[model samples]
Target: MSTPEEVAPDADAVTRFDDLGISGPVLAAVRDLGYETPSPIQLATIPTLLGGRDVVGMAQTGTGKTAAFALPILERLDIAQKTPQALVLAPTRELALQVSEAFESYSARMKGVHLLPVYGGQGYGQQLSALRRGVHVVVGTPGRIMDHLAKGTLDLSELKYLVLDEADEMLKMGFAEDVEQILAQTPEDKQVALFSATMPAPIRRLAQQYLRDPEEIAIASKTTTNTNITQRYLVVSYAQKIDALTRILEVEIFDGMIVFVRTRNETETVAEKLRARGYSAAAISGDVTQVQRERTVSQLKAGKLDILVATDVAARGLDVERITHVVNFDIPTDTESYVHRIGRTGRAGRTGDAISFITPRERYLLKHIEKATRQTPTQMQLPSTEDVNVTRLARFDDAITAALEETARIEAFRDIVAHYVRNHNVPEGDVAAALAVVAQGETPLLLNPDDDPLAKAVEADGRPRRDAKERAERGPRTERRGRGDYAPYRIEVGRRHRVEPRQIVGALANEGGLGRDDFGAITIRPDFSIVELPVNLDAVVLDKLQGTRISGRLIEIKPDRGRAPRREDRGSSYDRPRRGDDRPGSDKPRKPRHKR
Candidate 1:
């Protein structure tokens, strides 16, 4: 085994993709995607892969590794030879689909180049037909690819290039055996490329067993978090997240922003809430089509959209120069994900801001993230009602100043004002004040701290407002748990399928557009799991969940008529309190009034 070579990211050395021997149609496609320079991984891996040598790339998810392999494959592709020549294996269906889309984007100018993405949940008929018709490249998950190979429907005998993307993730997901089996079926002399964020023992062994004297390229920085970003965290309850987020939006000055959530359904839920509050916002998730995702990104770049609520997979490889802020609406499960989420901003040496919401139970995750990144995020205090009022007043003053500059438009209004003053025998100042009131509309112009629900929810110390007696009685609310109003539902995935509670929640929330509060107890059993969902769910939402997949198994959800399983029989249960539940000190749920 040889040591991997460290590659310094010199954005100034090779300013453009054309400088790296990528020319003609491929370079044109790259320019069309608004990429002007190659990333560190691309700068090191492209020429090596193009030179026909096996390469092992060590880089993080947001480091442009997809293009590092995709561009070279496209450049060396034999379009006329439609048989599978390149096989790229990803760990999940979402990544496989995203890689497939990247291939399509890079090969836009090439004629007669066909690519197919084979993954679970999708119908096999389409994949089988595409494979039979012939394709230049195939990107798929390890399990589905192995299934195809066993069925004799996928032929890798003619394969020339193979890429194992996120290999460590595949291993962790229990696909090591399947991956090895698939690798064994490929040609002995074919070129191989393995990419992983971290090289564990299993990954190193797999690379050594397959790759032949591979050229090692490692792209890493001294600190994972960028110095150009000012990172901050707010301690807020799940129920208070929306209020804190909206308050931040009101006070923070940002050009463009992305709010990241853990589940796809949360993306739509958050984005819709932002829009209803008069922000130009949109949602992007795996459920969204590639075309719509592209359009939304374009709108963000073009200044038509101000905020985007996106899931991790959906925002992969998203590069926008205008993004000034990244908000982790829900804390990521892993430290690497946290790094990647904040990496969306503070790019190209521009200063950016990253804010995260952390609950008491998730404080340990934050500590892990800070330890991994080697930088502690500053604690942020939510903007006070007076702070927001001050900002509003400043903007109102600026609006009046700008209007004053438009002499031509103001002339007409000036004459009307004077005529009213003369006819009603009113002073000019009083007339002006009345006009200002009319212009401000029905919504109040300033926030009253005493009456504001958001102000009443939190105190100066950022803790939930509580009376002295109640505070002593309840102590500190550490963890919130309850079984809300929900009815039992059964889905055909369980311990047998190695499915987890989070996976089930993600799949259902994404497909059904349900918020986290809509979910209740999730009890995983041997063959099937019993989940509690909102009662009287729409028939359409149920149909959507029936086709959704978790661990490559269809949910096949239906009403669970059986009695609730015994507590001992339940493998796991997620009994978190609903978002709208009353807080410890509050008599009722707090709903903040929005003036925007």
Candidate 2:
């Protein structure tokens, strides 16, 4: 893949890293680092940093933001001076190491650039030695650097630049005082650069006090769900999503899938359950070692594993095209992560799908996601009895067809059928009926004979169809209620747009602030749909929804008056004459006038 700079030349249409108009040495270094274009933050901040200006950058993870300020520090490094010319402070030990590595990548073209990462977890012996050797750049966590400062092992007398990466996260983690003290230890005139995902009040105040009229650049979270993904969300309870996910897997023809959970422990638990159910699934999380994490990701990409239950941090830099689905086993904390989660699939322009499980309590979050992503998730109902039956029949048909195609003993079965028909002297029609009855009885299709089996199964499990074993556990629940009570309100889209019920829900939830549970029964037709929303909607909501469009057509929401109106009432009441007579009064007055 091309470097961020080379690929996105007009990151914000300012000077990209490659086009930064920096010294030849710096440009060469960037080229050697394999960067073709600067990231958005880099393109925005590089020019100012090179011009000796301080900056405040508001960006999120995975945006290559470290290189934005790191490159400029390298450009201005005074090799002859040899003193620490730049100091980068990170919130966490992990981030400090990452920043130090980035600095090294940018300075590879420079000789004797000497960069050191100082953090608390590692031995102090190495850090002290590096500081004593007088490195040009010092990248360390807030606490460790302060300790070194107190011990007089590190010096910032010659510091020219200072960077605080993920400043807000650090502040949240209770590193504010440490950060402030470290800043105090730096040179008074040092150019400070602060980068954070969110600009909370404290962070902004710190930037205002410390930074020198800094330029602020904020990249709002990207809301584009991969167009290649056919995204859906199933409304299942917290306790039931596991069962529901299994059921969905059984019905869906996914080649590979990634299941995202919020916590590391949950990753392991969910993966174990999936494995116990005989799926080719595994767990990956922050607690796992580098080797194991890499191995897990590799297995997934190689198609050795069908499912991966992972946390967000563990799944970083993962790209797999065959990932046909992404299951948000637990909802993401924020919108940005949701975009990244779905982005794992739908790569290389290949079409994929994503499904999320939303519980009743998470309906608000479901609406929030829809608003952020601009797509509503379909409010999935419990699968209906009829729907489940149909799906089961379809599965049964497929199984029978496969058996007939692959089995070599067709003659044996044929002979048995012939013997039975001849011995019983049965009519050919009667024989076929008997065979049909036997075949149907053996299959699960007729369990809920009058409903869609998949729908019934989903409703019974309170999730989507996952795998076979889960279905066994959900066997023979109370039959679902009839779908006949639904009243359809016409939504005006039709066959021209190729819109599905899920798309409609996603659009509404994403755009109209509707939740997954906000909708009732939905009836999709070739050209239009008569969907049911909750009864007795307030006028404000109705008015707000008036003149809206779904699937590129105007959705005129009105009361469903089932038939054509009578012609007489169509005219205004003012247009009809009154029943009282006027001719008699006029005639009596005329007669009196004639007599006079």
Candidate 3:
């Protein structure tokens, strides 16, 4: 399909809120937020949206794109009507909540204005109560929105504006069908705005089918990886991440940092461990109040706190200039998230550092991010205890020198020390040494991180870390199984059929009714693929899968010769290696990145 013509936004546009015909409470809110000018996306989108036209905006995360559409929606909102005049569909619940908060913040002075953010996991009673109370704006994820519509709790009759934010991500998460279904239920004359960082074919088709005479605008963000940020990656097994993270933390020179974890529970778990290890750390998650979150962030900025362990939601829309580092304790699910995570640091012409912990299996995503960003992150080696010790020594020396620079305080202390030395007849150096011991406190002067159980596991039984992870026993694959092992089965679709692992997985999950827990290793070879199924497989499942057509051919399942297929040899996929290709994800249970 041909791409739509881009209406390029003027990078040097001299647009103001007043110039764009925005006034009243919305403008006052903007001024309160200290926004002096509109961004490129805002300049291009706000005017068209305010003029009551459909808009297709293209911009990356952190590009001030939220304000672009939010301001216009607020300006046109009928505060007195309040029956869901505007609907925003975000891919994740975190984004939905953030957008809802932004709407509330921007419409603070607009009397009678009400906004509601609906998503999964939140109690339905709370959302139902808000909707019954006659909210003016509704923001939600596709699943929860569909739920509300199905239950008739959410109404769209008065919806004048509908926004599909992060459309590409929603499509990626298998929400394209849900999105279309929801769009079908919206008012026919609704002003639709679809925004995405990258316009894949599916999103394009969705836009073509829905948006009418759209004002397409592209905000050309600099997608280049900031050279000022040093990016590094560590490939470790899932069980070893916490240990590896601690070692990295010990070695890196950072002022204030954000450690990104996948879940709220992980944030607390990691923060507690870091605190136990003598680091000033706090966990930020959805559980924390807004006041507590702000306090923690303020403390982080003031250097009273050093590390923040945050879930995706708590970290959303967070802008703290003092963030010197960002550690992805768990790898992000997608390339866009990776970009956004690293973007947390390295802002405003300041240098920053980003470190990502990669599991062996997740290497595919790493390669995807590298290709997207066009910069291969340097592979990081685990820091030794000596490295930590040296860094600690250097910092200690710097602190002592700074203390000595305080002339008045040091002179007073110096006289007290001299008097003590004179009275005790102890050598001056001995007296100073005793005080140094006090200053050192109870913290270990040096750590032998090599002796850590986590590190020991990596080197367990004299096996190399890579060997330990790669060869760990999960279960028997089709070719690897002996006569008694879980029976191996062959599906006549493989590399020759251009069948990827995900496609095979989908077929098994959809047709066989087997969950991920039921499956074992999948080996896709040139002509056929081998997968391990249950020993006494269900007759119904086998019957359903007997003739499942894949890649234009009916998939045929059969007993396999008990010899392992060339598993995704990863390095070359075969011993006859020739070219450049490496698969990184090792056999580990990756915690699924629950959206929001």
Note the Cα lDDT for every prediction shown.
0.78, 0.66, 0.72
Model 3 / residue 413 / CA error / Å: 22
Ranking, TM-score, top scorer first: 3, 1, 2
Give the alpha carbon lDDT tens digit for every residue of 1-596 in model 1: 45788877654575678877798899988886667888888888898888899999987665678889999999989977867999999876656876887788788888889999887556667887999899999999776676577568889999999999988767655466668888999999999999988888888889999999999889874337888989999876556788889999999999999999876778999998898888999999867888999999999999999999997778889999999999998876446567888999999999999999876434545555666587889888878889999999999999999999999999998999989988999999999888889998888889788877555443422453344366446542222223444788999988888776646654565445454545766777889988888775656567656766666566789989987566666665444333223222223532321211
Colliding pairs, model 1: none
Query: Which candidate should be chosen as best, given TM-score against the real structure?
Result: 3
In model 2, which regions exceed 4 Å deviation? 1-15, 23-29, 32-34, 60-63, 80-82, 198-200, 218-223, 227-321, 324-344, 348-596
**What tens-digit string does per-residue lDDT give for candidate 2 at 526-581?**
56665666564445456655644454355676766566335532211110011121
Residue 344 CA displacement from its true place in model 1, Å: 12
Each candidate structure's count of clashing pairs: 0, 41, 8
Candidate 3, residues 457-563: lDDT per residue as tens digits? Answer: 43432222233244235322233344354567788877867765544554554345343334555666677877767676656567767744454455688767756
lDDT (Cα, 0-100) at 82 in candidate 2: 64
Q: Which ten residues in a row have the lowest lDDT in candidate 2?
A: 573-582
Q: Give the TM-score of candidate 1.
A: 0.54
lDDT of 3 at 357: 82
Best by lDDT: 1
